[model samples]
Target: MSDIQSYKQTPKYETFSYLPEMNADQVRRQIAYCIAQGWNPAVEHSEKENAFGHYWYMWKLPLFGEQSVDAVLAEIEACHREYPNQMVRFVAYDNYAQSQGMAFVVYRGR
Candidate 1:
């Protein structure tokens, strides 16, 4: 977890707000499900201003070799705790291609 805390009550950065359908529980389970099949995982998010665009896709980090869904979920939860009102996401990457993977927001707001 980060020692620094953000009490801004909202994402000071850009983020997507239309993907609550992909909540934390779902994302965590989905990643676990995929990794059980031998896929990898990573995470990322956007600033507040970029949130709420239904058709927009947020930026993300590269697919790391880290396949621990628990750790990723922990990171996601920590991110939400640090930025309670911000947006956060998780990604599942398989051995398909470098730029091919699944991405979705896992946290909407506090």
Candidate 2:
């Protein structure tokens, strides 16, 4: 198996929930807003009814040298405040599972 497959058992992600009816325009705007705040956009994927049954967006922010989880969560909270309609969730996993990472915001379609 591939290295990634070998690590498949590892729990490397966390999820956040958002309105499931957001349109593409709104999703794009939210992503742009997050980027403006200095957070890096790592992955973007779409899901159909057969998949997640809704559409969503996921982002990642780098935790530079010794940054605390609370600090990162605060940044994510700030983004949510900036976008009232958007819901953001931040999760920090143990190093054994994954390094410092976040789910950021997930815009679900209504």
**Candidate whose TM-score is highest:** 1
Off by over 4 Å in 1: 1-25, 52-63
Our tally of clashes for model 1 stands at 8
The sequence of per-residue lDDT tens digits that candidate 1 reaches over residues 1-110 is 35333545434222222222544566667778867766667656655566655433333454467667787777767666767776676666667675435666676554
Give the clashing pairs for model 1.
13-47, 13-48, 14-46, 14-47, 14-48, 15-47, 15-51, 17-52
User: CA shift at 81, candidate 1, in angstroms?
Assistant: 1.9
TM-score of 2: 0.31
Report the lDDT tens digits of candidate 2 across residue range 1-110. 13232224532223323223335455455545544444443433233232233444443444433234344445554555554454444433334445434443343222
What overall lDDT goes with each candidate model? 0.59, 0.40
lDDT of 1: 0.59
